[model samples]
Target: MEPPSGSPDLVLAFANTHADGGGRPERFADVDGLRAWLRENGLDEAADDASPADVDGVRHLRDAVVTVLLGHSHDPATDDATVAAAEDDVRRVAARHPLVTSVDRDGARLAPAQPGLPGALGLVLAAMTELALTGSWSRVKACRNPPCHFAFLDRSRNTSGAYCSTACSSQVAMRAYRRRKAGSHD
Candidate 1:
């Protein structure tokens, strides 16, 4: 599916790499998978040197990003401790792949301090920074559905998008109805 309007393409693409609330096969499960993903995402340079360790690192980054998106959705399922841990993971990755300010006639922006995998990951972090600066970061959220916590951009007027799609919303409602009915039987 197309990324939500106003959402950073890089961030959306990177976060969704985990795929289908992680029920599906991991996109970065191995070196070959990581290389393929990097190439598809236009990070061809990183693809060449993709390694097993890089796969682990990228997966860690993706998980942290997904957790942050869940928090953005204000999903009650995502606890404070989980968000905190994710944030900490992000900080640790950021330290390893620091971004530097680059200014020119086009204005200033964050760029990677390193090359290869670090640089590619830095680009993802930069996208998050850009969105946060514009106050649109919160709009990038994960669906509330436990088995389908897909990341999406909230397009609601009040930024109240809770699920990724109507199907998820309907599923949640149906589940709630079943729960209520079951309780009524007691």
Candidate 2:
């Protein structure tokens, strides 16, 4: 799963690693599970070298990326502060592990400046940085519906995708309809 050729697929996959639908536990339950994720992302060598600390670092990075993307997906007019805060968080992490520039046939790409916990963490950050630089950050988002919080790419023409799937969107819409109907009764 080398990022699926999509600009934001890696970011979405990183965020989905800890998806908590309903009352279910995290998708990656432990360090081993995190290793599985690394392997799934074609980072088998990184997974082999991962530790508990590495798992935690990946989780932190994933959360930070999700927060930033969530900010992008939400209405910036009213959520400017939230977006700013999330950008600050991303900057803080980037400051800790700066990315380096690399050029190939595909042009320049950002790579981890230095080896940090779970070597793949830097690569993940690089992918996110690329998305931000390319103005595709909003394509990656967390579902607005609570509990699901699954990350997804907004492929809609107007970029109005707020849910990971139609099921979640329908559930939220139905709930709103019920509320409106009940209110009219009053």
Candidate 3:
């Protein structure tokens, strides 16, 4: 599915590296996979020297990001402690990469302080920062469906969107209906 309007492509791409309800394999399963992902996302320089540790770090970052998005979706399953931990993880990773403020004729923005994998990851963080500043971060949500949990931008007029697609919403509704029917028999 196309990324939701107003979502940053870099951030969305980063958060979606893991398998989802669609059954896609982990994109960062190894160094090679991570490198390919980086290249696909236009971080070819980082891809050149990608390492196993980088793969692990990127996966951790991706998980943290998805967790945060799930929180934004207001999924009841996502508790405060879980969101807190994910936020901490993001902070730790951000510390490692670091960002510097760049001011130009266009405007001031954050840029990676380092080069290589860490820098590329910093770009992802920077995109998140931009989104937050523009109030678009909260709109970036994960589907409420347990199996799916796909990250998507909520374009609803009231920002109440909870699922990545109608398919997930229907699946969740059908499960609820089945449970209610079974409970009635019980």
Tell me the tens digit of each residue's lDDT in model 2 across 96-182: 766677767987877766552434666777787677677777788887776677788888889888888898888888988999999
Residue-level lDDT tens digits of model 1 in 71-108:
99998989999999999999999888788887779667
Better of 1 and 3 by TM-score: 3
Tens-digit per-residue lDDT, 71-113, candidate 3: 9999999998999999999999999988888777967788888
TM-score of each: 0.92, 0.81, 0.94
**Against the true structure, what is every candidate's RMSD?**
3.4, 3.2, 3.5
Q: In candidate 2, which residue ranges exceed 4 Å CA deviation?
A: 1-6, 22-25, 75-80, 116-118, 184-186
Q: Which scores greater on TM-score, model 1 or model 2?
A: 1
Among these predictions, the greatest TM-score belongs to 3
Candidates in order have lDDT scores of 0.83, 0.70, 0.86
Q: How far off is residue 152 in model 2, in Å?
A: 1.4
Please report how far candidate 2 places residue 25 from its true position, in Å: 4.6
* Total colliding residue pairs, candidate 3: 0
Superior by lDDT: candidate 1 or candidate 2: 1
